[model samples]
Target chain A: MTVTVRPVTAADEAQWRARWEKYNIFYKRTVPENVTANTWKRFLDDKVPSYAAVAVDDSKPDGDNIIGFVTFLPHMFTGSIEDQVYLGDLYVDDEARNGGAGRKLIEYVYDWARQHDIYSVYWHTQHFNHRAQLLYTKVADKTDFVQYGKMIKK
Target chain B: MTVTVRPVTAADEAQWRARWEKYNIFYKRTVPENVTANTWKRFLDDKVPSYAAVAVDDSKPDGDNIIGFVTFLPHMFTGSIEDQVYLGDLYVDDEARNGGAGRKLIEYVYDWARQHDIYSVYWHTQHFNHRAQLLYTKVADKTDFVQYGKMIKK
Candidate 1:
């Protein structure tokens, strides 16, 4: 099946959320409803830097076109004049894995970042996600950087 | 030495830049002059989300009070309603290492983020940065996440 990528639109909400929720479930996260609502709105708002794109199969019907989604945002980087983008969320439908959807989605962001003069597109992933890393290592370079964070207890 | 953290002002430019350059040097990076200029301007502009705070020694003379600096900015997070901050650049002067300046600088950002309702403050460090990790382990939790990036060639 041939897959194509494009910016997410308002009409894509239901399917997007369906997949977004499943994506969160895979990571064992329970995101509040408001954050999901805000994320959808920001993707459609030009003023907000956050954005999302979807990978769709050309052979699929309109309502069922989307098989994967990616969320990204450009932010200031001290090491470069041009902003760098963070590939925040990326997931493909379970049945659609290994069909090039994930890689296509990432290439879509790389193209978008380059068009905006962003010189770097970076992301972090769990060490145990060896499946995703297989595709990632082919499309990007894995850096020797580790993450540390202070999580505030509510 | 009693280290205190405060929002950086215009008067702190020289010292901030000196330490910023040194920070970059330690990572073996040569940031362009324009990026450095823009970074300084963003820190002072309330309109921009980017911010910097300096760690100072109360007993030192005015010009020399600055010991280290941390740059951070809040951005929307997909998993939460509240924004999260990225502690971008952090450095303490060579002679000032082990004086608690690094920890104090991080604590300052935590306070600022908490006051603004940001629930997470995260940063990345090179795998070889065991010195900073020593302090990091005390103040934050290290994650099993590794970084991946695709750098665009100009």
Candidate 2:
């Protein structure tokens, strides 16, 4: 089955939300409805500078149901000494899995970054996300940098 | 040689800039003057929900000159569902090295976190920042979350 990717639009919100909920569940967590709604709103909010891309199947007649999505934001990198794109999230539906949709989504961002003269695209995923890592390994080298967080006790 | 820690004020701008310049030099970088001014302005800008703490040496009779500073922003963790403090930047002057100024800055932030009922306080430093790591290791447990980044090529 041939898959096509497109920029996410307001018309795709319901499908995107369904896929996002499933994606969060895979991580063994659930985001509140309001948070999800806010996230979707932010996607369409140009003033926020956030963007999202979605993958779809063209073989079907409708040719526009989103099967996967990727979200990212513009960030300044002190280490790189320049501005770059920061990929925040990427997820593909189980049915659309292993069909290069994820890779296409990344390449779409890569093309976007190239047009804008961005230095690089960077993101972090959980250690258990082996499948996503397999796809990521093909595109970029993993760095030794680590993420750490601690809760401030009230 | 007793040192006092306190909130940074507009009056401390000159001393703060000197210390910040030294700090940036150690990193082999120089931030724009306007950025430094903007940062100081943020401290007194009540509309901004950010704060900074400074380490001072009042025993010198200069009425407490700035030696070190720590800036933090309040954040809410989605997964753990807790309110925490994200320590953005912490810097101490080289002249103040080993003078307990750095430790005092952290201690003040720790106390501030506690009073606010913040569940935790956290920050990240490069692997090569041994001195900062040394101070960090004293107050919080190091975490295993890894950070990864990629350049989006044009």
Candidate 3:
């Protein structure tokens, strides 16, 4: 199966939502319907800096062969003149693992950033996500930074 | 000394720039002059989502008694209906250390997020930054996520 990456389209909403649900479940979290709707709308809103791209199995005749998706956004950074891209969410359907879809999706983001003149791209993953780290280690350097969070409004 | 936090203003540019330089140095990074100018402008730009709030020693007669500052921006998140704020850059002057300035700075961000109806606020710190971690632990939970990054463009 040949895996290819492309920007998400309006037609990919149903398939994207299905995988988005599974992505949240894999992390043991649930996003409410309203939030999911808003996120989806942001992806399509040209005015919004947020974006999404998907990896598909080109061999499949039907277009619903999305194997994974990546969501990212560019924001101003104190350390750079150009915007930095934050890879907020990334996930691959379990069945599509080890086929290079994950790496392809990441490279797609790199290309997108280069075309847009973005300076850097960064992401965070759970320490327990060793599998993704394997691919991450190959493509990016793991920073010494550890994350901290506070739920202001719960 | 009495400390208070408030949104950055046009008059705070010089003090803000001085502390911003130190903040970047604390992380062993160098931002170009152009980037520094742009970042400072964004802090005061109402059209930009990014914001900066400064902690000041109100007891000082001169308004330049800024102790530290925190910069943050809210963005769409898949797991929540409300925007999640990223505490991008935070720093407290070394001279003002141990006076609760850091905690006050963080709390200020919390209040800012609450006022904006944002749900969560998060940030990252280097593992060796134990001094800051002490205060961080008091105000926030250390998450399991580790950051990874790639410089697609220098």
Candidate 4:
């Protein structure tokens, strides 16, 4: 099975959505269709300053069907001299697991970051997501950062 | 030598800026005047969803005001069902040290968080800021969370 990883385009929306649905199921969460549609629209909307990349299988000849996807946004810290890329989502189909598709998507992001002179890329995941952690450990340093939150009264 | 902490109001802008200037000076950085103004405006802007609290010394009946401040924004995490508050900044006058004004401001925020039924309150500080860390330790769990960043090319 030959897999190709490339930047996401409007043409790959349907295939990408199918894979995203499977990915969402693994987490046992259901994203509303409108939200998903809006996210997809953001991926293709250059004015939004967000980017997404996907892995596809070319052997099927169905215009390179997407099997995985990653999305990120650009931000600058208040006092930091450099800007950063924050990874929002990364998902690969189970069938394509360990086939280097996920790694390729990450590598592509790294390359994009390097080419654009981005200082670093960061994301968060649950402690139990071992597979994602395995891949992440290779590309970035895991920090001691934990998220904290409080609710506000209306 | 008495110090007080209170909720910020539009009338406190001038003194707030003075304290903010001192706050930034401690970090060896000068936040642009425009950024400070915008931040103050955001805190008081009803259309915007941000909150702020201030520390003041009432000893000087005239023009005796804000010595420190903290600001935060309300947000909901994707995986968490409850709303959370993200603390944006915390500052106290160096001269007001040992008066417990800093602690008072933090306690106010904690009470505010509780009133809103928020599960937790969180903020990030530089690794070397021991003074801030000391105060934080009294209120929240000091998790091993570390921040990492890569710069993006302009």
Candidate 5:
């Protein structure tokens, strides 16, 4: 009857991968299977800071009900004294868009940050992702700095 | 007489601080002492992914001859098969700018990434920081994505 947001388990890899593939497609990107496999493995690795949270439908079976997911990692910043949680990805199944999965996934990350004593939780989206920006505006303040970077190798 | 780029040691904190302060001043940004201390501590802790590499004039005494520094951390990216080295901060003393200290410091990070089997190395600079861009162009390819993020809380 209710949507649940929680840490992902190994059993949800297939659903997580599907959502990941959809998310990448939204950006016109495709991740190699090896990269996807590694990302999923990191999500379960205790030694790695990588994590994934998913929103699921309680009315459906476990893996099939995962409608949305978010990934985040803790990072150190010289600008602040506390660690920052960098929200790397957030996406909800197209069919689950308006049902609050996106918002719940982000809030889940906020609580995670609070529990870890992380002072800031931040993330970025493409300039053209206006739909996501609409939701982003409601949940967090749009920060000041525009980021720039170069890729050194493949 | 030559510039030596290597991982920072505890003895280099003062010289590192001096260069770090100058770097912040260049961007009109100031990091509190506690944050600086935390960053320095992370650089030395093997458990943390954060790191600092410095370029120094070895012919001169140890710390005082330090001319530049670069900070980087290995991070997970959902799109990658492997972790990437995120180069967060890099600065060369104004007097030492043209002596290739900055380039040496970046190359040092590249070698570090190679050793760790990181798939890529990347970083960003302010839109107005043309000087750094000049060097970046020489060593890496300009990527297409624009970064955006919100600072939740601090």
Candidate 6:
């Protein structure tokens, strides 16, 4: 099947949420609806640099349906002399995996970065998620850095 | 020694740079001066959400010595429903370690987050850095996420 990627719009909300729910399930995470709503709102907000895009295949039964999504942002990070875009989230519907959609979504970010003259793009995953590593290694190089975070709200 | 953490300013450039360079060295990285200049500008930019705070110790030799700094911004992330503050850079002078400066810096971010109604603040550090982790563990719970990134520019 052929897949096309584009910036997510208000119309993509339901499809994006469905795919995002599945993505969270894979990580055993449960994100409350309020947060998701806020995130969607921010994606459409001008002051917030957060953005999202989706992959759709016209050949599928649900033609032009959003099958996957990638959310990203440009932020200051240490590895680059210039700011880099961090791919905060990337998810492809389970059945759609390995169908070129994943790579297309990432390349979409690359295109955006290039257009902005932003050179680096990155994200994080668990060490044991070899399945994701397979696709990730194909699209980008992995780093040796470890990740740590403190959740202040809880 | 008494210390105060406050928002960084144009006058803090020299001190901020000195410690930020040391910070890069601590992580075994080299950041070009241009990047640092750009980051400083971003912090001062009104439109960008990125911010910076510095810890000044009056008891030190310089009378009002800038000992360390923390840079943070509110961004969209997968783990939370509301926008969380990302503490992108946090550093303390080696001589000033274990004096509650790190905790104070973190608390400063918490204060900002609270005032802004933001729910979370997070950062990444090497797993091997147990000393920092000791303080971190005390302040916040450690997450199980591993970081992965690619330098697409190279």
Winning candidate number (TM-score): 1
Docking class of 5: acceptable
TM-score for predicted model 5 compared with the true structure = 0.85
lDDT of 1 by residue, A118-140 (tens): 97999999988999999999999
TM-score of each: 0.97, 0.68, 0.96, 0.61, 0.85, 0.86
* Candidate 6 clashes between residue pairs 3 or more apart in a chain or in different chains: A35-B81
Off by over 4 Å in 2: A1-4, A61-64, A75-85, A95-98, A107-121, A127-130, A152-154, B1-14, B17-53, B61-64, B71-86, B94-122, B127-143, B151-154
Candidate 2 structure quality by residue, lDDT tens digits, B1-154: 5778888777877777776777688667767766676667777787865788788876664634677888876543323333556676678777778888877887788888888777678766776677777777777767754446565643
Better of 4 and 5 by lDDT: 5
What is the lDDT, from 0 to 100, of the residue B4 in candidate 5? Answer: 92
Task: DockQ each candidate and list the results.
Answer: 0.78, 0.33, 0.83, 0.23, 0.41, 0.48
List, residue by residue over A14-125, the lDDT tens digit for candidate 3: 9999999999888888788988998999899899888999999998865669999999988777677788899988989999999999999999999999998898999999
TM-score of 3: 0.96
User: So what's the TM-score on candidate 4?
Assistant: 0.61
Q: How far does residue B126 in candidate 5 sit from its true spot (Å)?
A: 2.4
lDDT values for all models: 0.92, 0.72, 0.90, 0.69, 0.81, 0.82
What level of docking quality does candidate 4 show?
acceptable
For residues A57-153, write the lDDT of model 2, one tens digit per residue.
7776553567899887654432333456767678898878899999899888888887777878877777666787888889877776545555454
| Clash pairs (backbone) in predicted model 1 | none
Find the 10 residues in a row with the least total lDDT in model 4 chain A.
Answer: A145-154
- What is the two-chain DockQ of model 1? 0.78
Model 4 spans > 4 angstroms off: A1-3, A150-154, B1-154
- For residue A107, model 2's alpha carbon misses the true position, in angstroms, by 4.3
RMSD of candidate 6 to the truth, in angstroms, is 2.8
Q: Please write out the lDDT profile of model 1 over residues B105-141, one tens digit for every residue.
A: 9999999988999979999998888998999999999
**Which regions of candidate 6 deviate over 4 angstroms?**
A41-48, A61-64, A76-82, B45-47, B61-64, B78-81
